[model samples]
Target: MSIWWSLHLRRDAASVPLARRFLLGAMETAGVDPEISFDLSVALSEACANAVEHGGDRRVQREQSVGRDPWDVWDEPAGTACGQYRVTAYLDGEKCRIEVADSGPGFPARRMLRTSAQQHDPQLYPSLSAEDGRGLCLIEQLADHVHFGNRPGRGALVSFDKVLKWRKGALLMVS
Candidate 1:
């Protein structure tokens, strides 16, 4: 069986947990192993937090300057003027994929370089003391596959997937 869900959420702190909870509930209901579910949930939280905290304001300003309605471009509900982020998840067999996209300035090129450097030479790069920068690292460690990109003229996209392992006997019940 395959399951998928998408959430269009306001760029607010509260929305982060909402997204995480939805994912956790979905995984629990589907009998996804707790360990796999926990890892995905934490990664999802990081992604959502990045979107809410960093994705919206600059994009909104750019859209307004061009006389285009920002929310309209994203197809957000009418009357919702705030910036929005989207989270999507797909589960098929033992693989689960999740994407978090934001309408902010895309991931900085330098940060990507830094991440690469840190991965290759942790002693040289060390950990960033800045409030930001840890989320991508956490996501990289937790997900089996990770991809980063931009959304055309708009925002940043972070996608990650994990190959799940079922609890003993759970696979039989699912089949």
Candidate 2:
């Protein structure tokens, strides 16, 4: 069976763990290996954190473009705010896919170039002392496949997927 869920989370720090917890619960229920789940959760947190920190800029830009007060979005309902991000997960027969999308300026062209190079050799682009610039690398290392890009006029998108390794007697085991 294929199971999937999507969340529209506020651009707040708390949403990071909330997304992770939901992912963990889904993985546990599907009988995914704990180690794999942990890896994915960490990667998810990094992506969510980036969104929480940067996603607001795009909302402000969009609001300005449409002649609305940038702060007006804040008055909307919790999840309905323009300053929000999306997290989606899919657990299929043999793999799980996770995506985090946000309303931000998106990655710069140079960053994508660096990301491609890092994917080939992450060691070549280590940020030992820096606070940021490690999230995409971490996600690349944890996931079997990762795609980073933008959604046209929307914003940044980070999509990653891993081949599911089942625990003993997994509910959705493909055996």
Candidate 3:
């Protein structure tokens, strides 16, 4: 059986846990091993936090420059027009995939390419004292496969997947 879900969320702090909780619940209900579910949940939280912190400001500015109100462009309800991000999760058999995309300025192409090449060395990234450097590292360590890119002139995209191993003798359950 396959299970999937998608969320369009405002770029707010609360949305991080909301996304994490939803994913955790889905995995648990499907009888995914707890260890896999926990790791994915933490990785999901990091990705969502990155989107909230760094992914929507540039998009809002671009929209305003074009004389389109960001609130209207995003169809966001009043007082909640900060910006938007998308999270998608898919589970098929023992494989799981997740993608987080934002509408802000995408990552710099040169830097992204370089970072991808050096992901194994955490020293290539800013120190933890810096406010915004740890999420990518955490995601890299937790996910079995990771990809980073951009959406043309729009925003950044981070995707990762893991192949789960069920606990010994755990009955396979699908919802």
Candidate 4:
């Protein structure tokens, strides 16, 4: 699989929708069906929103866009926050890939979930203390994979994937 683009942006409300359309269109342009576009949109939107809220401040958010370096230049720019969030949108033959990263202080995926959360919750609960926890949880439920891991000195990556499934459902797609 080849990653076409990895976008890095600040933690701002203004950029949320722009980030959504970027992933949605990338999926279609890579041959993902329009029927599931909404799913991808919702998942990616929430991931990016989490990055913005927990990742860093305005100076860090607005200045950190466009990069190819995975580690070297990643944290040098935002020393205050110590880690940056990244959204990698790419495609393979059968699946569209999206990853939202926030390399801040965090535990690995195994530790983050408890026996209580391991159980299913249809409503996808969000915490009252913070407005953003639900988005990642929802992404996990909706996307094929949602990964969370610490990125060395940075933070974590919430990787999202939606594999293209053929026609048990294409009766639902129009174009």
Candidate 5:
């Protein structure tokens, strides 16, 4: 049986590379198929990228000290993503859950979904194209569960989960 791995990572754009490495490691250790690994990588990359981009404008400082891998810049303390934008990764069997949190203003999930449809619907006018807003759509397609909510006065948390393979298109079981 594949083992479940729980890891906490500091929230920073530089930490994204580390997240990918960790996921890839878990995938390899679990003997996950190449195709599935590819999917996991892509999904994880997008999630981590979102964390980094949303972490902060000038506040997203990446440390390059002590032989920086150039991939993971090491954000130091958690929650202090400039003030504590933590990222947590959970891997169990063929299931994976990733959460990215930041101490900033939250977004409206409904509006985000609606805008995504309007942008990627293809039927929409070309003049209404949105360069952004596609991340959540892509994420929803990749993950079985996509949740967004406010962290009170902190900021927001985006949670996503995926099952590697099994019955295709299977819904994410809550229990």
Candidate 6:
């Protein structure tokens, strides 16, 4: 059986857990192993958190370009009005894939290239000394495969997949 779902979410903190819960529900319904479900949920949360924190609004970007603080723009009540992101998940056969895309300014070309090259090099990323920068690396560690890229002027996209381990009575077991 094949299962897929997608969500369009406001760039708010609450959306992170909401997204994770959806994935967990889907995985549980499919009888996926709990350990695998947990790992994917953690990865999904990181991606959603990054989307909430960094997903930009064009208006907010413009404000920052002209010397206004980005945080100040977000501090306004309208911060989430134009900021949105998407999360999609697919489960087919033996693997499950999840994708998170945002309408914020995409990754810098240089950093994107560097990160793609060093995806497996944990040492290349800084220790979790700060709160904000560890999401991408954490996602990489959890998923069997990951891809990071941009949608031109649209935003950044982070996609990842893992080989699924079925529970004893999995409804979608391949074997």
Best by TM-score: 2
Over 1-175, each residue of candidate 4 has an lDDT whose tens digit, in order, gives 4446887765676677888888776665555576667888898888777777666532444355455354444555443343345677766556767877664554445535323466376543565677445676777777776666666656667776777643433322223
lDDT of 6: 0.80
1-175 in candidate 3: lDDT tens per residue? 6878889898899999999999988887777899999999999999999999987765233434455464343343221333888899998877899999887776666555334467767668787689777787788889988888876656778999999766555344432
- Order the candidates by TM-score, highest first — what do you get? 2, 6, 1, 3, 4, 5
C-alpha positional error of residue 156 in candidate 1 after TM-score superposition, expressed in Å: 0.5
For candidate 5, what is the lDDT?
0.58
Better of 4 and 5 by TM-score: 4
Candidate lDDT (C-alpha), each: 0.78, 0.80, 0.78, 0.63, 0.58, 0.80
The TM-score measured for candidate 5 stands at: 0.62
Q: Give candidate 3 regions above 4 Å deviation.
A: 59-82, 113-118, 167-175
lDDT of 4 at 139: 74
**Candidate 4 to truth, TM:** 0.68
For model 4, the stretches where C-alpha displacement exceeds 4 angstroms are: 1-3, 57-72, 75-84, 107-132, 165-175
Q: What would the per-residue lDDT of candidate 1 be over residues 34-110, giving only the tens digit for each residue?
A: 99999999999999999888786562344343665544546432222337888999988879999998777777665
Q: In model 6, what is the error at residue 26, expressed in angstroms?
A: 0.8
TM per candidate comes to 0.80, 0.82, 0.79, 0.68, 0.62, 0.81
TM-score for candidate 3, residues paired by index: 0.79
Model 6, 1-175: lDDT tens per residue?
8899988888899999999999999999999999999999999999998888877654534443365553333333332324778899999999999999876777767554334567667677867686567887788889888888887666778999999999987999887
RMSD of each: 4.5, 5.0, 4.9, 6.2, 7.7, 7.1
lDDT (tens digit, per residue) of candidate 5 on 68-103: 443332233222344334566665656777777665
The list of candidate 6 runs beyond 4 A from truth reads: 60-81, 113-123
Colliding residue pairs in candidate 3: none
